[model samples]
Target: METIVFPFSSKFLWAKYLLVFALFISAKALIKLPINGTIPAVIVFGDSIVDAGNNNDLNTVIRCDFLPYGQDFAGGVPTGRFCNGKVPSDLIAEELGIKDIVPAYLDPTLKTQDLLTGVTFASGGTGYDPLTPKLASVISLGEQLNYFKEYIRKLKAIAGEEKTNFILAKSMFLVVAGSDDIANTYFVLRARKLQYDVPAYTDLMVNSAAEFVKELYGLGARKIGVFSTPPIGCVPSQRTLGGGIERECAEDYNVAAILFNKKLSSVLNSFKTSMPDGRFVYIDVYNPLLGLIQNPQKNGFEVVDNGCCGTGNIEVAILCNKLSPSTCTDVSKYIFWDSYHPTEKAYRALVTLILQNIIGDFF
Candidate 1:
């Protein structure tokens, strides 16, 4: 269950919302290295799951830099992360001996020194398909790449060309963003599903994703990690939307993810030979997330189906705010902080799984 990696050459792409980052630049935090990891920096890319604080500046309805969203965060302020606290990228960054949270590339207060490590460039409601981001008015994957290009140009201005080049070559990159494709595109709009069945739609996703990974490799990323499609059918929101089935996972969506992930792994493996200089790793989260759902007690979770905020059935983004009817007293016991995103505790557990099982190969 742990080794279904996509397997790229040097540069890669993970397909999930909480994926890789754009640029690293923030003067507020200290730059420190970890004791056991060899990574020089971490770059993130994707949607809300890994957005950091980029969405705060967006003129879209997908923003969540508001109350109760970050009740468990450092100072109880939402930093645009869809989760209760740090997302997976933040935890993985700390594990890799890098800084804790990656700054948002769109932040206006970023300093020259912040470019030395890494920064995030995710947008809420984004996906491999353009229709998803357009519907939510967030940055698309292609737009994120454009931002990455801009980031490289900015880094060249602060650090010399050679130094900037060295940093990018040595840094580890993570890319994630397929849930939106499922939730917003296929299920809600039926745009993609109308033309293709679940299997065909999954193939389309992998094909588009492969192109994105090739684009990243061409941009100088070497060590890349891609997130395998998680069991979106099991998320509290999906359970609610698919006929009010509490805690019961949606088998149809799970089947789509399984098919999509298999094709994604295969496409990535074949795409690698073309880029002999890049290396790709496909990290499977479906099994791990399912594990948490099925054995909540084993994982110390008292609530695995619903979230801690409000009703926890369908509320998300600004809807899961302080204005909600009522929030749970103990967020730690819940696996989810909201309808779709996992709780900070759950993200931490996933990070431990990656560090212990997948991150070793990144070095």
Candidate 2:
């Protein structure tokens, strides 16, 4: 039997008016939300901080495709995430109501709808420095941009030139990199240190970043959000490497991050004038991340010093495998999921701050 459902008969004018009023209220609420308008897509670039498992397919040891990495993700299946769950990029997409999940650009299972929404091109351990990508065997920012160009061609074929142009112009582009440049290039190997001092090296990074932003602007990216480098000195891996046996935050590395962020913010500020039609806003992660590390309890974290995987001091990527008995049982209590990446809870908290900061420039 067919069941007819209705609050009132169509003949009841009051019921119809009440329904329309409710819809109007709901629409107003949606307009006040972060994403007041529909975005065509969200193009991503940068390193592991925003990588949505692009490294899984790459032939490199700098990967997190095994167990203990995505233990907190849906169904507990590892998906090459450096953390126990979603990263900042994923959270940002959710906040914008674009898509609850942001698939990797390289994901073989990606559908046409996924392309219509957004995808990530970020790879673990990549940076502005050319050698940084080489060292990790991951996609570099330059190569990522090349892929973006390819995507544009493919999208144009599907959506046509006019619609594709409109989509690309209306979409948001996010950049979060440079941590590996400092950690892997300068500190770990000390290769560039011989040729350039700390200040000079930072200048090189800022120059590369600026060039990338300008290139993106030229490619019709009107709304761009460039992420500031987080405090590298405070991460568990850096702490173990540079901190004393007690494991303290390395002040020198943090200073480099601070200097880079200062220069980056100022440079992006100039973009407002140089590219009047474009909106280039610097998203700050340093202060919030530092606060999380300094006062873990304030943010509902119990373990701020170490990660949840392995010993939490040195283990990361494959090192924090399921085979490792030292991996923590409770990822929720930890601020970091591994040596360099934060836990999902912490990432959610930090990404909210990032969203708040970009809401004005973005929506």
Candidate 3:
């Protein structure tokens, strides 16, 4: 009963209409998203840098399971934590309004409910390589990732797939290993001299670390924070070996660490670009800690060069915990807690710098 009129061709018009509908749906999905109200659970994985008390369960000679280790912590009982107090993960968890401590994965006592909050897979004296001799029956980076996978599976069982995915998607991942790899494997074992040239060895270490990160990504880790190596050459043990008072930071070791960090940063950037939804951040412990050491007066620290435990050599193995072992009365002033670790005060300051976004760009 009407004159039939077509606006151009019906086929082309239908296609355009469909395209417009698709674009509208996409926009809606991107814009009108539901806000995630829950705080992301924090999962920690690394070495002593973030280890809470995993070494307590191990028979490691390199342990802090005695007096002076937990002097700054509540109750003052040795918790096998390397520092006098909380580690980096603990501080980050506090900032996130999560649990006060990150629980160890190997703790047989941990229950099903604990998995919801998150767990720590870090072990003291562990490394990327399994062959590297450690103080305890240490866990390698691969082992830590495997433990994380197990944790996620259990989490899925309890929280269900949808909720578990949401938690992991928004959760923070803190990785603070690699120092032991250099300290124990490269420097102590003399692998740097025996196995490969410096540059080649650095690449090997960084690549191994990168692979571990990729594995974590595959397991649904969306937010990651990786710590670059601190100034290893400046550690009391290394410096002691360099000759006391005349002690200088081993530039060779520091150079290797620098090279590793540079390569690690590059790799992380590429990884982030490939996975647009994921966030990868690097914690530059090297410069910030180095700055504190070089300019201790500016940071309100008194002792910059030596540790507060045992001797100036900072010997913190089994010998450091003996009855006759020497310990500084005031641990708050010293930068190094032992030969290779930081004092609680130093660690706290480091945490503050991170929370204040001093090194926010490299993440």
Candidate 4:
């Protein structure tokens, strides 16, 4: 009336269980995300193009923390991104599988995980010119670097010294600014127009940009990509301001942008030779964006001359607020979200083109 247990049968069942466990482990490994090739994080610097909300708390009217700005973002919540959704900072991280969004280094709610992934120190209305941020009462490039230093200390605390070094060395670094320098400071505000001519002014901007890259390199960044300014004169606001009654692309603004880009490319080329260990790349957004503007229909964009918000001519930041009555019904059909910033759809296209061109050099 009693049953006897066999040791061989028990051992056979245990062997089957181990086999299944190993298979599961293998399957999981195979499907693991390729978050990055060699880069561990994506550190961003510069102006509104990549600000990612660093200006949200700053005492600057050069901010967009409410209504319509992030209408296309997850939960339709405005996170101070100057776009209808994610900006290039978020798009770049998303493309790299690093993260869905690159948090602002100054975001008070940032977590330790955000630091490990990356964060942007970019502030809207900032530029390579020292006076640019000052004029707007926003964070300057130098102040951004100071914030970066603080980020490094925090990262080291969370990730330890050795891992922090790896991240600083291998992470992708982006610098995107200068539009405000040419369009706002020199042209609209005339803050530096009387002191310096266009050629002299571009030289000043390039010098500042070059110095910034060198400082970043000294801080352990090796793979740095400085984005060329877009055709600033062609943006809706500039066209309205300087394009005369016809609202055409401001030719003079375009000229200054071209000059600055040429100098910037030259400086980056020189860095490649001088800083042999570092990879300094000049990422061109001018031609690609210009092509989009000149041939908007090619990219399914119907409105290249104006933004989706307000009159699409002058409203931006504080001006392009909730009280702006209405926004374009189809933001995807437009190239810009506000008078100055590109729409999320436009940023997606630009980011795709950029990654395709520079991924090889960066990795």
Candidate with best lDDT: 4
Model 4 reaches what TM-score against the true structure? 0.90
> Model-by-model lDDT, in order?
0.78, 0.81, 0.72, 0.87
Question: Per-residue lDDT of 88-117 in model 2, one digit per residue for the tens?
Answer: 777777766666667788877777667656
* Local lDDT at 302 for model 4: 93
Off by over 4 Å in 3: 1-39, 111-113, 133-136, 243-245, 322-324, 358-363
Sorted on TM-score, best first, the list reads 4, 2, 1, 3
TM-scores, all candidates, are 0.88, 0.90, 0.84, 0.90
> What's the lDDT for residue 63 in model 1?
80
Look at candidate 2 and give me any clashing residue pairs: none
Candidate 1 residue-wise lDDT, 1-363, digit = tens: 011222222243321211232212222223322333245578888988888878898888888889788777889877788888889888877765567678788877765556668888888889877778888889999999999999898777665565567678768888898888987689867878768888778777888788888888888888888888789988888888863434577778888888888888887777568766777888888889888888888778989888888999989997888889878988989999899999989988877776577655555
Candidate 4, which segments miss by more than 4 Å at Cα?
1-36
Worst 10 residues of 1 by lDDT: 14-23
lDDT of 4 by residue, 198-250 (tens): 99999999999999999999999999999999999999999999999999999
**Tens digit per residue, CA lDDT, model 3, 150-242:** 888777666567657766876778788777777667776775567777688778878887888878888888878788988888888888764
Question: How well does candidate 4 match the true structure, expressed as C-alpha RMSD?
Answer: 9.4
Q: Which stretches of candidate 2 lie over 4 Å from their true place?
A: 1-36
